[model samples]
Target chain A: MRPGHEEIKDKLPEYISTGNIPDDVKEHLRSCDKCSQEAFLLQELNKVQVPEPGGLFFETLPQKVRASVRQKKKGFLFRFVPVFTLIALVVVTGYIYHTITPPLTEEELFTDPFAIQVFDLSGLSEDDIPPISVDIADDEIYLTEETSLYREFASLSSEEMEDLYEALEIKNRNGGVL
Target chain B: MDVKQTRYAEDLRLIEKYLGGDEYAVEELVMKYQRKVYSLAYRMTGDIEDSKDVTQKTFLQVFANIRGFRKKSSFYTWLYRIAMNTCLNHLKKKGNDTLELNESIAGSNGNALPALIKEERSSFIRGSLKKLPDRQKTAVTLRAYEELSLKETAEVMKCSEGAVKAHYHNGMKRLKEILSASADSPGRKGEGI
Candidate 1:
């Protein structure tokens, strides 16, 4: 109720605990009803007793706690099961995407000139191309110089080479056009 | 080591054992502090059932977050902190429920008349406590009910010692007023004297 009453009340518990109330606080408590009541209430609040649960409560509390903890752990795992499954599905899908054989793009086909390229035969007639048969017994037709195909072409006369080059140019043009 | 240091050591040992997968360590830890936690909860909730529930929830939380117990404060202080928070939340959930005099006085061990009288007084005290603001109730609960030192109360409360003093002083003032009002008002059940 006074300017210093709050300070005294704050110190009251400490004073009571140590059994060393300062003379000023003691004097104040003697005169101040508010502070006296506060002190008495604090003492009573501390002294008020609560009933203890029976021995069975204490005996069974741990088991109850343990059961609850175990239930919680199970709940945690259950809660995350779907998340783990989702992650696994994503990873498996990624691996499958990378592992599957992919269709060759035109760029890939063009990058390697010698690589096999699929032709659209739907527009071409069989009679549009001529085929010749080779005699397996012709020894002179064999590749005598195995090192280079160019060496065999080098042996051709200028006129023959000119005709062969023209034939190759025509084949390339037809392949692209078709 | 002093007695407190020894307690800290034992608590740490049990915590370590619990964390290390010793199942019985949990039982040991629970047994050690259940009474104190229940006592604090009983004061805050003023009912035996709510007290039991709060005490169990406190331990459940403590064990669940045991890995986060940084040992910055003693295990006892940390336990009180969890118990206090649980009590506050439980009280909020209860939301202005008044204490039943008969239920509040159930735990007496002796002569009926004196015990009933004491319980009546206690019931009035708990009713008065419920009227306090959360912080003031907490301050009084820690200082008066749990018997924590101001510093320990501050640690459990996560506040400065000055703040605890302020809350506690205000709480005591309010309690005196409430008790006085109860005494004067004949409609009020207990004298709280």
Candidate 2:
């Protein structure tokens, strides 16, 4: 409870072990009953004898430790192998599923069944439909010639147009025979 | 580097080698620190067999967790920390079934009498030490017996130096009281140091 007894008490363990206290602290310890008692008890505690293991114990300990750890390592694998296998199985299953099953496109998702029935009735498979190319050049819509039956019709001469109209008239009169 | 730092560096190298699959490094490391770890474990448990178990567990734990041992603290301090934890856990689970003093003390080769006396003194001291709380017991063990510096003790105990001082001081007072009480009791006086 003196001005420096607290400090001396803090250093008492070191002092007890090695007698490394400063002279002033030693003086404080000498004068302070509580600090001196603490020092004594710590010194006594420091004298406690732990039984030493025999020479063979030290000599064989590393081997024992390594063997135990190796055993545990095997046990660790034993415990986790199933979990790892399950994880790998799940991953492989997921990869196969993704590899074989393509994702649906927007057109596939929203295709009309009625339109498909109409195409079936027309006896025209989807592959029979010409692919259309639209150009928006010069602020005007232009359908490519390959995709445009209207462009072919417009390119026909007047005599060929008359012949085609007469043939379509005769087929119409015969109830859509053409 | 100083001797301590040099040892730390050597310990780190051995640890790296062990981690790199060199089994001989394990032997080297265990050979290097087994005695120190055993001594601490003995003090903590107050029984030789328990100390051995604790020492084995400590090394196993150190090897098991060695990869996580960032070189932030000295390898010695980290080892002490693991050893201390292993000792505490061993005592916690085993409940400190210290051997009987008569059965525990082994006779030395040359002089039986001084050896017996020293063993008896040690037994009394360990009994008193067992009476202290865990933290206090650890503080006293590390600071007083192990001869670690206060800073090193704090690092091992994973507390500040101030807390180490407080725990050690309180432990000393409590130890003195225990010794005094034991000394005052009949038939226990001559056995004490």
Candidate 3:
């Protein structure tokens, strides 16, 4: 049967601690078989003591095991330190390399005199010259058209061109703008 | 100093020394709190061996992470939190089912009936505790066994006082039911309830 007399039955443990049980509830507990049995059971349950673990148990943990555990922990740390250091070094080195290298400039690619020849075509338009088809065959210059000037110019090396320019400088002194 | 006062003073000194980076302070700290930690672990795990393992692991974790422990909480509270978590994780890994209570004490089975009954009850309580939801078990253990106040239990549980109260009430009610069932069982008659 549900104890409809009071809600204090549900809170019996708390009320028991404070010794403030109402007279009606106290009378119910004193007379009611079920509630009294439950109260006795709770009292017995409360008195159940947990056994303390043996005193010597903790003391019995071998010193060697403790040392080994300590050693294993130290070993893990020691093993990690060098790997961490290497990673840090690689990252720093990569950062420094990236920061120090300069970018490529356009002047570096275009400044070589050998890479281009400037033609004095001040009075010439794109249509004045015959279309000359030049082919490099067997490491020798080949022109599809048999032109004397083309043969002469192609036969001279870059050093020979410098020599011709020097000779033309002397000739230009004798005859200006020739 | 009186024995209790001297021990308290020593615990404080050890805490200060640990903060000061003395290596032995950790050892002293472990020595001081091992029983409390082990008992808590054992009560939570329901196995002496598992409790010992959990206790060791808890101390090692505490030692490693002590630097992160702010002084806002008491050292014991922080330590208990670590121990509780470690025990819970261990229980979870083992599948959080009911653990069998050992029939023999220290490999012997000739103890008195009342003592055996009490032992069985204690083991039942420990097993029942595992069956509880994590927060409820923690709140119940901290309040009942550790005798921490509701406020202190809340602080350790990282919950509001009302939550702790609810957990405690529900946990105790469940425990009473479990114990009552076990007491009425025919197999437990030898336990002399």
Candidate 4:
């Protein structure tokens, strides 16, 4: 009676490792010529050793192979440096943009356009005018009585007032006002 | 001192030096393992020239990627993995069936059997190994020749232990059949089992 094929194949490594063949398996191996031959072949094959590539092997290797190898290694890093540098450059540019550029506020945006509005005297009448002498100091601005005739100049629109203010050298004391 | 012990100590020291940025350490490493790496390459590719190329490429890869090595595996095992990968890639590029038996085995003189056969049964075993499939060949070579444990072989081969076992068993079985048949060929006399 032959041992099953799967059983024999599975147990073969165990047998080879331990050299402990079971009684029935051994009997079956002996009787079944194919299995017996396979066993013999396995035993013979085990005797084979792996051959060394032999000494003096490295002597035959390419001369200064290490130099070429190191060069190739450097080549790999060199290839990636440009890409890494580009990435770093982009990141730094982004950081600088974020840090140096001030954030725009809603108040600044709205107030900047209306800056001239502060100089408007639209609701003031002649009676509402305080004596110019009271507000103007002589050292800052000489408000001569003759210049008081120009006080009604406030009735002009801002564009017209800007034109007249630039025409006179009188240092339009309140020219900056809207 | 035992050769393996002396070599192992030297290798460890060189690896330490290499990690420390000693450029010469790479050369020392190449010198130490070049033969083993070349032999593995030859076995995997069955071409002496290709094996040399593979060995060189393997060392290059090892040195280039050394920083990534976590020391979880032995240096030789790591080197073997590189050599195997290099050879496999070469084989794949060249097509697996393009494996020429005569390339590695042939010498200046006609099929140099005497030189190859003198190494007891090892040459015969190596010859038989060439007949197995590529994966089986790799598994058997690592397991039997490299003397790696089943687990280590599996790790190197990137397969399960059961898969390694299957490749190993099938490889051994094929080698047995081939060796037996070759031994019994017409020109050869029936030899001792």
Q: For every candidate, what is the interface RMSD in angstroms?
A: 4.4, 4.3, 6.1, 6.3
Off by over 4 Å in 1: A1-37, A74-178, B97-120, B189-193
> Regarding lDDT, does 1 or 4 come out ahead?
1
Ranking by TM-score: 2, 1, 3, 4
Clashes, model 4: 3
Worst lDDT 10-window in candidate 3 chain A: A60-69
Candidate 1 residue B29 Cα shift, in angstroms, is: 0.9
Q: Assign candidate 2 its CAPRI class.
A: acceptable
Instruction: Give the Cα error of residue B97 in candidate 2, in Å.
Output: 7.3
Tens digits of lDDT, candidate 3, B128-154: 566667777787677656645566677
Residue B187 Cα positional deviation in candidate 3, in Å, after optimal superposition: 6.5
Clashing pairs in 3: none
C-alpha lDDT of candidate 3 relative to the true structure: 0.65
- Residue A53 in candidate 1 has what lDDT? 71
Best candidate, DockQ: 2
- How well is each residue in A66-138 modelled by candidate 1, as lDDT tens digits? 8888788789889999999999999999999767957567998889787675667898787875543444554
lDDT of 2 at B2: 88
Model 1's lDDT to the true fold? 0.78
Task: Give candidate 3 regions above 4 Å deviation.
Answer: A1-56, A60-178, B1-12, B98-122, B125-127, B182-193
